[model samples]
Target: MATVYLDYNAGAPLRPEVAAAIAAAWAAPGNPSAVHGPGRAARARIEAARAEVAALVGADPAGLIFTSGGTEANAALLAGLAVPRLLLSAIEHPSLAVAAAARGGEEIAVGPDGVIDLADLDRRLAADPRPALVSVMLANNETGVIQPVAEAARLVHARGGWLHCDAAQAAGRIPVALDALAADFLTLSAHKMGGPPGIGALVLADPSRQLASLLLGGGQESGRRAGTENLPGIVGFGAASALVGDDLAPDGPTFRVGALRDRLEKLALARVPTARVIGAGAPRLGNTSCLALPGLAGATQVMALDLAGIAVSSGPACASGRQRSSRVLAAMGLPDTVAGSAIRVSLGWASTDQDVDRFVAAWGELAGRKGFTVSAPQAA
Candidate 1:
């Protein structure tokens, strides 16, 4: 049986070009920090990759700090801040939420649409002391709903707080300009964008801000992070960034995943009356749709799909234990049963119309049991 993967949100397969670049980079036997001829070649690859990444986000290459991945980037950036309060959206990934927890920060609530409430954010900022650091994601990993990061940034700046955006899910799917977004700090993951895993970056618009080191070792990342750089991974990440430009366009939808996704959802709802689309009314990414089939556990749906030769995930990819209601869905005001019923089908660069059809057929068989109600999941 042929297998179809519909979980791109968990991570994308590396592009062929990116894989070739990594192979070529790994063949080189010199550290980027060394000054010998071999070392110079390695350094050149790293610099070129930096340039490619800078171009993708319209950021200065000098402002980018390469790290192992998004988790490390968020931990390092948030752990270093000395603000009076660390305000993070409730819908953020575990990386930011964990960092905020470590710092004893407060969790800001989001609306039923899965977006941060600007008014609520303002209220929190007003009551807190000056120089707060606000952290929010550009697009949510679970729901694929785009956040109002630019407006959040503007409000943070007006109240003398620094804005940090975790663009892990948004970097390759949407247009992300560091200058245009006006965020002080931003984190991105390469694997989320068809690049190799283990290489990601953080961009700080204001380099003058004092950043403390999370690891203690020989100077790397300009002493902001320590340890030998993942040179091959970095090179692959740079090449992937260059590839992303080809996918973006000004008209229609730059990516076609959403159309196919809608077809799957439409069929599921038509066949399985109890089926519901989570965050259907909100704006979502072209590649993702989290659906809830009432009365069925998300884990059951995931297992059913995998057995059907279609791969999908329930909630965050990092989630552990038996699949239950997701914190994100619960925060959006869904009942435990509704949240637990959710399964995510995310398309990627390789996804095709045939894959969507396969998913629609498979979903109908698993979730179309009797007594199910097909309705949109309510947001908090």
Candidate 2:
């Protein structure tokens, strides 16, 4: 049977334009840092890609630092911060959580709606007079709930602190701007935005700000990050970023996907009256839905969907692609069963009405089943 892919948040499929761009970039035979003729050509291509990627987030091209992916961008930025206190939201991605924890970061509370509690943030910020760096993801990968980064930014700025937003899940799905959000640091992932994987970027609001190097012995990324850049991956990222403009308009691809997500949750709720939509109370990206049933384990749900030829994630597919219960739902004060049973169905650019219909049919059947035989989920 043919499979319907619904796990865009895990990693969107590579776009055709990006693939073509990568092919063209791969044929170029010089390093971006060399001083020769081919090197100048390579450097020009890299600069062009930088401008394209910067345009997507309304950032200065000089402020962007390309990395291996979003994980590295978050890690490098957090690692370099020399703050007296570091505050993290309860719902941060592992990259931010882990890196901030290494520097003695404290967790701030979030409401049951899966949004950051500005009061808790205020308390944390006020509790410490020293400068603090705050980490809040723009949109969550698992629940798709959007966070109040801009409001947090204002508060942090008032307290003479800086805010870092991991826009990995927000960037090509919803609108993001460095100035509009007033974030000191913002990160983006290529694969999450229909580009090639293994490449991403971090943007600084002020290009002249001194950033500590993630790597030493080279001047790449103006010495903030040192390594030979992934030329083709960067090219593909630029190509994908160029495609996002048409999708962000008033009634564009994102709006349609949001409708499909609503339809999905509606059908799931009608078919299984006990079903719960995690993070439904908050503003979320249009492409994602987190649904939970009372009795089923999320792994069981993922396997059932896999058997039915529908692809979804039990939670955010971690680095290992393992089916894991959601920390995001637990952070929202959900019951253990609700958190354990939640699965993420994320639509994207290629999603259609038929895809939603088939998913609802498959999901209803699985939820209605008397028993389940276990297997691995194909998080493809």
Candidate 3:
């Protein structure tokens, strides 16, 4: 049996070009911040990658701060905010909320459509006279619902607040223009966009803007982050971003993963009864679908698909090992039955039409079995 990977949102496989870049970087010897010859060579690679990442999101290379990954970028931003009140969209990734809560912040609500309620945000902003930071995700990790971040930025600024958009999921799949999005700060993860897992960037509208460093030492990342840079990971990420830049140009198919998702969804709906597609009525990433089957636990579906050599995710990968409803779906006002039954199918550059067809076929066969639901491994 052949294996099919449909969980790109969790992490995409590194492209051949990106892998080559990593290999080359690994062979080079030097600290990027050092002034020596080897250091200069490594520094050159870092700057080139910085430019590539900046190009992907329409940011200036000088303003891009490389971090260990998306989580650190988010933490740095949340920790740096000077707000008396910190407000985050309920649908944001756990990293955002976790960082905020660790610093004493509040969670704003989202509508059934998974979009932030602008009016509600306006009200909250009005209630707080102190400087506020409104953190909203550009694209939801689970549902792929794009937020009205530009408008939200306008609203936030009008209320004398700053806006931070977590653009981790949106970076490669959609065009991200910092000036157009009006986001004061945005986070990008290389792993989500076909880069190495250990590297990512925080694109700040102003590089000089002070943010508390999440890590300390060596004064790297322009003192915003401290540590010896992960040079190879950074190089691979740069290579990935450059590739995305080439593919993201006019009339490119960098995001054709969605087409495969639609095909699988159609097949699943046609073959399975009482199956409901979560976020069906909402605007989601083309490659993601959160489907629900009553009496069929998400873990059951995930494992069944895995057993058939198809890889799909359940609820959120971040919520691995737990059998709980998606907080994102719950925030969207979905009932437990719908939320708990949801399994995520996300495709990427590696997914093929046959993968989708196989998933549909496997789902049909499993759903038809007499003991499919009862035999599934319980969430550990």
Candidate 4:
């Protein structure tokens, strides 16, 4: 009865190296901003971590601002960027979506594959002559479908608009280059990549871009994000980023994990006639599978899986206590029932074949008990 954790998208388990780094950093006692000897030592540690993190995304170390987490980083960008109008994809994370909405930002629709509509973006940009800031996620949190961020950036730049990419879900699982994506701003979360949960970063492509400070104290993070840095968390984040090297390669850990995800989806679809994999047709992250069980509620399935000592989730873990229909699936045009019944099963670097097999067996038993026939679904 070993427990299998499959909800990496929520927050990956902390890596041993990251934990060790955190422990070491916690032993130091000096504010990074202080000019004293201990402070200089602390500042050096923070700068080293910054370099490690910046390298992961091909960003200039000086241009990266450490924030509390992905949410704060996103909030700072959405609020601080000097753009008259903001446009974001409908499938963006709640943090981005809520921040955009609060600023009276409009949403660009995503297609059934959960990919942003480029034509709609062009039209929207043309319809409005105002200087705009476009936010599009690099990969979807629920379905793991990768977006055409580089292409979107080209469009945004052509129209004199800046492109901001939320790469929280894509950073460690894939190769994310700020230059390759051509994003003006990019967001990264450490917790999503097996690092400490309290620290994340906002990467700026241009060091000269005007960024209004979100927090106005201490003048930390080059006065872009004010506040004392989370030393231990930043250390952990750096350790985790270093370990993610080449994991996004074809023969890397991520590719193997994706194979496991595909196997799980294939097994589920074969055992439960009504089960379908959402966003299967699109290019998705190797470690994520969004399974929709037509007649079963996602909450019910989540609880049942938990009872079996398996960890899975209905949607973003950020929405834990307020479970509802997945906005991501809905944006993909799934009906309320289908979207509500969808559960996301995400793998990680620590995932193995046994975890996948155990989940499949448990899910099959549950589906059988729910009166679902064991038959393969017809091809779409």
Best by lDDT: 4
Residue 81 alpha-carbon offset, candidate 3, angstroms: 2.9
lDDT per residue for candidate 4 within 1-380, as digits (tens), equals 67999999999999888999999999988999899998999999999999999999988999999999999999998778778999999999899898778889999999999999999999999998987999999999999999999999999999999999999999899899998999999999999999999899999999777788988976888878777889999999999899888777778888888788888887778778688999999999989999989889999999999999999999998888666798888888999889999999999989987898788878888888898876533221
Candidate achieving higher lDDT, 1 or 4 = 4
TM-score, candidate number 1: 0.94
Alpha-carbon runs more than 4 Å astray in model 1: 250-254, 369-380
Task: Please tell me which model should have the higher TM-score, number 3 or number 4.
Answer: 4
Per-residue lDDT tens digits of candidate 2, residues 1-380? 67999999999998888999999999889999999999989889899999999999999999999999999998888766677888999899888777667767899998999999999999989988998889899999989999989999999999999999999999998899998999999999999989999999989989998878878888898889988989999999999999899888878888888888888877777767778888888899999898887679888888888988999988766633555557778888988878888888999988887888788778777865745332222221
Our model 4 lands, by Cα RMSD against the true structure, at: 2.3
For model 1, how does the per-residue alpha-carbon lDDT over 49-86 read when each residue is reduced to its tens digit? 99999889888888788999998888888767777878
Against the true structure, candidate 3 reaches a TM-score of 0.94
Residue-wise C-alpha lDDT for candidate 3, range 17-85, written one tens digit per residue = 889989999988999988999999999999999998898888989889998888888877766656677
Count of backbone clashes, every candidate in sequence: 8, 0, 1, 0
* Candidate 2 vs 3: which has more lDDT: 2
Off by over 4 Å in 3: 249-251, 370-380
TM-score for model 4? 0.97
- Measured with C-alpha atoms, the lDDT of residue 307 in candidate 3 is 89
Off by over 4 Å in 4: 375-380
Which residue window of length 10 is worst by lDDT in model 4? Answer: 371-380
Candidate 2 Cα errors over 4 Å, as ranges:
319-324, 371-380
